[model samples]
Target: MTDALDRIRSIALLLPEVEERVSHGQPTFFVAGKQFAQFRDDHHGDGRVAVCVRTSGMDEQAMLLDAAPDTYSRPAYLGPSGWVAVNVAADDVDWALVEDRVARSWELAAPARLLEAGGR
Candidate 1:
């Protein structure tokens, strides 16, 4: 929906230096021209978005899996590393969480200059 897209775009704007485009038939938010997060729509209960992010205090990937396994899963190959996939459509998506992860992903992918401009 346009509303969801708008929300995502708005979040992307928060990342000082990032690009937003359509990739893999979905809205993708990139950092340094690399994909960090994407939105997908599925008719089934399958995942409707892939949110890749970084963690510090604890393993972000594991955080999602342990906190919300039904809605989040380990990324295909990066699962062992620390990348988690969240199902935005699985439940009432917490936009705040989405915003946080997208911001974190952007932080990870964004360059230092860009991060500085984005106010970290």
Candidate 2:
């Protein structure tokens, strides 16, 4: 869980104007005051350590869930809103995939002005 959090923090903070805060008892990443991703550690005792991130929409969410059932899941509270919970704690976790998802989530949450500023 600690390693997963460290990896998420490293990727999330590289985006422009991103910040981390404790929201809903988990580490959450935000851009321009809007949430982009959250790090969950056995949230609600569900026995999963994952990173919950917003997708482009339900279509993308469903595609991800269908394509990689082992890596992605519809998170509890955020699922209705097209969010994906990525299993980052797996031993074979792909850091590149996680980085891509984090970047995409940041893009979804970033405002136009911030987006124009570009990410790192």
Candidate 3:
């Protein structure tokens, strides 16, 4: 695994019921069998290492992309579904922000009981 993938795995696995599996040639994180996060490496020649996660909605996706175009983007194949991508390979990447987003994604996909347990 690359450093970016390692970092994502470390943070993503901390959430309750989070599982890592390879999906579409990328490392994907699932909560209660629902995909919450996916680490993409040069996806279809995009030349980026990113973690795609679920956003609250299209508004959130637009807000994030507008706020930080360098760090956030509309992920391919999943963008229409309200998933946004964070550029994890950028030199100015903010890992804390990534963690926060990943946690939110986990909460979005996790079951009600798992979420009620604090999702830690």
Candidate 4:
């Protein structure tokens, strides 16, 4: 759990203007005052450790859930808002994909100026 949280912290903090805060008992990442990612460990006793991130929309969320049902799931609270939880506690976890998701979420939450500045 610590490893997953640490990795998420490292990845999320690398983005421009990103900040970390505890929300709902988990570490959440924000950019430009908008939440982008959250590190979840057994959230609500679901017994899953995941990094929840915002997608482009419901279509992307459905696609991800369809593509990798084992690796991805629609999180409880954020699921209705087009957020997908990527399981990072698995032995075969792909850090690159996690980083990509984090970057994409940051882009979604970041302001236009930050996007223009670029580089996560």
TM-score, one value per model: 0.70, 0.97, 0.96, 0.97
Candidates ranked by lDDT: 4, 2, 3, 1
Question: For model 3, what is the C-alpha lDDT against the true structure?
Answer: 0.91
lDDT of 1 by residue, 1-120 (tens): 556667778887766667778775567777778677766554234545555444442465666688888667765544565766665654487888878877877777777777667545
Clash counts for the predictions, in order? 0, 0, 0, 0
Shift in Å, residue 89, candidate 3: 0.9
Arrange candidates, best TM-score first. Answer: 4, 2, 3, 1
Error of 4 at 88 (Å): 0.4
| Comparison by TM-score, 2 against 3, better one | 2
Best by TM-score: 4
Clashing pairs in 4: none
Q: Taking the tens digit of each residue's C-alpha lDDT, what string does model 3 give over 31-75?
A: 889999999998999987899999999999999999999999899
**Candidate 3: which pairs clash?**
none
Weakest 10 consecutive residues, lDDT, candidate 2?
A: 111-120
Q: Please, what's the RMSD in Å of model 2?
A: 0.8
| lDDT tens digits by residue: candidate 2, 1-120 | 798899999999988999899999999999989999999999999999999999999999999999999999999999999999999988999999999999999989899987776654
Candidate 4 lDDT, 1-120, residue by residue in tens:
999999999999988888899998889998878999999999999999999999999999999999999999999999999999999999999999999999999989899998887656
